[model samples]
Target chain A: MTDDTDDIKGTPALDPVISDSVELRLARQIRELDREMMPERDLWTAIERNIADYPQRKPFNLQGDWMPYGVAASLIIAIAALLVNVVGLEQRNSTLLAADYAIDSIDSGYVNVRNPMVDQFRETNKNLDQATLDDLYRNIEIMAQARKDIEMQVRANPENTKLVEMLMRVHERELELLKQDYSQPGRSL
Target chain B: MNRALKATLSGVLLAFVWAMPCYAAVDSGDLAGKRVDLSEAAKPDGFVKISIVRGDLIVEGWDKDEVSLVGTLDEKTEQFIFDVSGRDTRIIVKIPSNNTSWCCNEGSNLRIMVPKGSQVDVATVSTEVRLTDIRGGLDMSGVSGDVRIQKVSERLRVRNVSGEITVHDVDAYARIKTVSGEIDARSIKGGGAFHTVSGEIVLRDVTDEIDVESVSGDIEVIGRNISLARGHSVSGDIDLEIELIDDALVEFDSVSGSVRLRLDGKLNHKFDLETGSGSIRNRITDDKPKKSKYIRDEQLRFTVGEGDGQVNVSTRSGDISVSK
Candidate 1:
């Protein structure tokens, strides 16, 4: 009709074709073919049977978890540390008791013998200068401190005979100083 | 001031001065004096034994062939008896029992002179004993008075109670002991043993084997060319400065007392040192210390040079210091 399709430059032009009976005949042949199909057995019943035979799984419980094993291990370590501390303390206490007994027995006899000599020395040297007296007192204090240190060591090592002997020696030295001071001929004068 | 008042004051001052007794000069002329001489009939190498009670006793050695005794007797007591029988001579200065009670206040001061190379033995109570220029063995004991010996050339033994002992220029073995006094020994050649309780011991320039022990008293030894030395103390510090001879062995032990040792810089020795509850200061070698805990005990085992000499030191609750 009015030549609605125009030929464009540098393009190929289309050719029009008339309607044919071949299309009608092919559509009529498809309508004649079978459209319905069926399987040989029911697949829903097999799925149901397989599901019934499957094994069941258990539910999760937090009470029976692995945390108790960790707690048990920690408890064992704590008990071992405590036992070690207790044994050490007992040994230390026993040593202290033994030391105290030994020291006490020796001190009584030594003090009795030292007192009179000390008194005599003090009376004889009553006229000495204050500085000399102070120096003597200071030395005595040092000796006392040394004695205390030895006693402490003895307490830690009760069977240490050397410590006991040293303690006695310190006592004797204190008395000797008092005696020697006044025993010199010109000292009292 | 008025003349009368001045005169009165002067008189008072003179009387006061006269009333104050002189305490410096002691007079012994009032006491009796005697001397006894024995001929060479008393052997030159014989023994002289003396026993006295109170006052000073002086024994001297001379180049004589006879034994002589000069006694200063107390007017209140009997004269000393001299028995020169056999090869030994005995002198007895007798004192009354009451006079012996007072120390250094009674008894005759005997001066006995003997020949060289003569053995001498003296025993006294409450009296000072002095021996000089002796060339034989000496044995002396005293109570409550000082004992002094000088220039002895043989074995010497002295024991005392509550008195000082002083020895100088001794060239033989010596054994000295005191109970509550100081011991001062110098220039000894052949060393022996010295012990004290509650007294200080000072030994200077001693050689050969020496052993010293003390309780509650400090000990100091300073010398050179010492071959073998051992020192022990309880609650008393020990100080040693020595030059070790070849193959010398030195040991020191203490309990609650510090031990200090100074050796010659050129010494070649092996040191075995240990301390409990104490620290050690070693300036002898560069060897490291062993592992310890609690008390921090210092144990040192090391050798210097070829380790020809040995030094062992141990202490408890005290310090040990070694230096070159």
Candidate 2:
């Protein structure tokens, strides 16, 4: 529309106003611009009218509205990642605890209970607050001590089959506990 | 070309591919050049061992003056092997070379047939050992393949890793140590010792002493008539059925699996059973009475058969049941 006022043509000194040819050309360019922009302008007007009449107006002032959406999407992703990581860590911890128990109990073999692996595993996994690992370690210690005592008693009473049998029972119990620990499951982590 | 001709050509090509191995040269050197043929005059010897470097070792005992083995070593393929040499007094077989390596070119399988009274010693790695109808001691060491023996009388000793030991009709002692494999022994007339890191031990119709120690896996013993049976496992069940003779002593210990002992009424022996958190049940005969102790209110001790031989049983978290 403003281009109509700036139209100047013919002899530059002849007139301060636009000449007929220049005026016509300017008018045509303006018309073409309007023709190109009319649909977009109408669509914008319709959208503005719809938003004005919409029942649910935005609660917050929508200055830089995409900021909130981006924040929400980032929160969702963070939550999903956290959940996945937590679940994975829990599973790993579970398997690790089981394996620790098995190794401590000597379920794989005759464990000496003095094995450093047991201590190292307990110390490392204590953060998970796994009571089983501690319990297993303690039980293994007790069993090992019992085995030693029984062996001593048997040696003292070599001829006494009854005492020897009782001691043997103790030894058997120790081995059984070790096996149970091993057979249950392995460490997950 | 016609479609029929093309089809026939394809069929022939397939047949040729399949039959390639059959036509391929099977070097007898893989057999350790050890082949034993039985003679009508061959006599049963005390012991026999044949160590070969290559070729199949085929041993068949008979009534004869001497044991002869013909070696057919191929000029090619330098694979390791050991086989039978000669039968002097007993059969003494050794590897002449200092080669400490082993090979399985002929699928590494040794089929040995000895007389009913012949003893054998086999030492190989990664070769399946098959022995049948031998009456003397059978010593085997360091094998990585499956070991199968049948009707072998005398002591059988096997030490290896990752191999199954199957023995039948063993008249004497049998001791085996394996890393991870199943051990099945049946009709053993003497004591048996089995040790494994991870494996199952199954015994049937065994007499004399039976001792087995394993980290895990169930132990099933049926028709056992051993005077002393001792089994220990870290985490596995001990399932047994036998007659506890007057002089028999049976003990089984496990970590978490139940101990089920089924005994004959004729079983006359004492039992000392204990477990951490499991119950113990002992069966008594109508003829002979029994006495038990709940001494300390936790430990259970019992005596039977005039309190002769002792059978100790223990476990950590499994029940001990003695039933007829």
Candidate 3:
């Protein structure tokens, strides 16, 4: 063994040792190692006490959060605004449609009121003279043409109140003519 | 007994004298295309009633204090009866009771001149009746004949079934009705009811209260100082250019025809307008309308000036336009 220990510039050096037999070298290394290592003390009881004193935690849920509530509130406000707008438009449209329906109802009522008068006149004046009857019929034809013309105008303007009133007036006139002719003083119906 | 017998004989003598012809130039010959002049003494303010079956009847006011009939008769017609007694004069072109088959073909054309300020009542079937420059009330009715009256100063009542009625310069109340003939009246100082079935009614310069009703004919009224104007039409357009007097009321009702009202520039009225299924183009006000969400009809209620006059217009389906 060459000398392996050397003192270099005020520092101590260690000698290098080598072993040929594996078991004898391991025994020598084990004998040279320090064996005085110890574990820390056990605090299981204290940890258990601390854990028992602490408060319990609940499971997290997205619905219980403030952000979800804010989003839901905003959604409700938006839907309400949209509903108000829709209702306003619907009301405007319904008003116009209702007016049209009323006009049609009035026209139907006029027809109902005029038909009976016409029928009664025809029944009473069945034996009127040909010339007188022809005169009455010719005049009635003129009235009918006027009515047709008014009706055509009404078709072009369905909402014309004057046209509808004139139509009723025309019907009333026809009835009046029939009634007057049948009720004439000299006429034997 | 003697006194009673004498009284009875006197009564018989009086009856014989009354039965004699009072005025006897009663020409009974053929009067075809010939002027038959007959005059009868009458009071100044007496009444003349004329009846004809089928003929053109013309009555005019003259300065004379007598009633005269001067016109031609149809060749086929035979009898013309003129009776004047006391303050009444009656003229009739008699169609014999056996001649019931005669139409308007056989008739007379009589032009009777009555005293001024006389109440005249004339009736004819299928005869055109014309009355001019009459000072008293006129009551005339015709069937299938046109009636034209001008410058009548009293109440006028004219009725026709299928004949046109034209009245001009009527100073008193005028009531006219026709079934299928046009009624053209102008310069009517007193307003009355004008009704027509299918004939157009044109009224211009009519004053006082007027009521016009038409079934299918257009009504055009250009009235001045109209106190109360009520117009009701079924299907005819009403064109009114009216100047309402103080505290006047004008009401117009229509079913489906448009109404255009041109009010005078000095109109002070409260306008109440309503229309179904028609929009209002109001130039009267610049304010926005108070639209009801439930009722779709257009309504305008506004006051103009002091609102002394009222204008009420209602329509079922027609537009109402009012302008100054």
Candidate 4:
């Protein structure tokens, strides 16, 4: 296993080559640095032995000690992108936690301000023809299921801003649907 | 046993059994259609209202200052109300409010001709409303009925529960919404907003602005000259092939759905694209996506040309494809 995993292979990246402005800036900064002085001690063989135990974990293909600053800048940009979308619906978290939590704190703070007529439509409104009524119910169920499935996806990818935005959009759809009496047409829509 | 009496009783029983199905048929299906034909004078820029249960409505606009309604209502229809007051006209066909699926078949077939500039409003349960050559505005809503309309030159608003809506040749602001029904429109010469759930949306050559939202439905837009666009979906893919103006604001968001943006003409927008658990493939500009060392997310932030406008696209578990 150690011999097979010694040369950690890199999978073909699905994205375009990572050469954005920040990366270019960081690359320029890296080029300006001089060769680092030798450390007091080096434990390359011990690190290799420890890596043999966990052959599944692949190290990030990053070079130089300045990589941490680059990562921080990227994280800042990502968070800014997220804040542009779900500021009202999302609960603000000061720090990013470990990946151990199954669901995000935003899920608890997010409440779907349902349409007041949703319960009425689910319970009453028998005057509608069967086909239309059935379609309505099926759609309601579909929307409910869609909401659930999206919440599950949010739980899985807590750092995904698009998923959170998608969840809020589903809630907005629910609100729009609730404000309607499907049996009647809007004279002034 | 009395043989004559027993024979007579058996014949009566058989006759009663045979007649039961005929009575049931008469109660349900065999209904005569009630005909309605009426014409009233009205203003050119007046108001017209129509209501029906279910059927095909063929409504058009004429140059004359009159509203003519000709149709056959269901025999089970309780009332046919056609009234014209001043410049307003109302045509309503009423039936028993509580009805089963087998209540009406091929419902009312109405052909209405209104004035050229009449703002018409229609409501129905399961009726396919078709409007054509109406120079004014149209506001209509229904449930489970497909809508087909054309040649409107004003604000057009349509809402449906589970029916497909198709619009052709509109020259004003339009807002069309549906649930579980596909929306297909073309040649819109103004700002347009279309929304649906579990239905695909397609638009072509719509100019001023475009806003679309969907769930579990794909959105494909090919516009000639677009200034602003906003599209959001969950589990629905979005494909936009557009030519933007100088100041364009394009934003797209999705979860578990891919977004493909193909641009044409001179570029002057900043691109802020990201994807989680997915990859961003940028082919339009020299700026490439930057991958995060922590998670499976990539971000591409760059300016194309002078960057006069903004273009943001994000997806979770979905790919982002940008091409020129």
- The top-ranked prediction according to lDDT is 4
Which ranking of candidates, highest lDDT first?
A: 4, 3, 1, 2
Q: Write the per-residue lDDT of candidate 1 for residues B245-314, one digit (tens) a residue.
A: 8689998988778999999757788999888878888888777656486557888888987899999998
Candidate 2 CAPRI level: incorrect
lDDT of candidate 3 over A127-186, digit per residue (tens): 443555567678767766766666665655565666667677677666666665332323
Per-residue C-alpha lDDT of model 1 across residues A1-189, encoded as one tens digit per residue: 113223222226433331233345568899998897566777889888888897566665577765887699888877876666676666777667766887766666766776786687677645433433444455555555655666666666676665576567667656755564322221222
Report model 2's TM-score to 2 decimal places. 0.49
What would the C-alpha RMSD of candidate 2 be, to one decimal place? 30.6
Please report the interface RMSD of model 2 to 1 decimal.
17.8
Q: After superposition, how far is residue B192 of candidate 4 from its true place, in Å?
A: 1.1
Instruction: Return the clash pairs for model 1, or none.
Output: none
Off by over 4 Å in 3: A1-132, A139-189, B1-35, B76-79, B96-106, B287-296
Reference contacts preserved by each model: 0.00, 0.00, 0.15, 0.50
Tell me how far the alpha carbon of residue B167 in candidate 3 is from the true structure, in angstroms, after superposition.
0.6
Superior candidate under DockQ, 2 versus 4: 4
Instruction: Indicate whether candidate 1 or candidate 2 has the larger TM-score.
Output: 1
Question: Residue-wise lDDT of candidate 4 within A36-122, one digit each (tens)?
Answer: 867688888889998898787555666655688888999998888778546623453322233224344444443333534566665
Whichever of 1 and 3 has more TM-score, that candidate is 3
- Candidate 4: tens digits of C-alpha lDDT, residues B93-197: 666656463364777898999998999988987888899988889988887889998999888998887889999999998899887889999999997999887
Poorly placed runs, candidate 1 (over 4 Å) = A1-189, B1-41, B99-106, B288-291
Worst 10 residues of 4 chain B by lDDT: B23-32
Tens digits of per-residue lDDT for model 3 on B1-324?
Answer: 999999999999888776544434344555544667778778888888887756688899998988988877654445556777788887766454333345445467888899978998887767788899889788887668788999998789987878899999998999998878899999999888898877899999999999998767899999998899999876778999988987899999777777888888577889898887766656666644455686768888999889998999877677888877
Question: Model 3: how far is B61 from its true place, Å?
Answer: 1.0
Docking class of 1: incorrect
User: Which CAPRI quality tier does the interface of model 3 achieve?
Assistant: incorrect
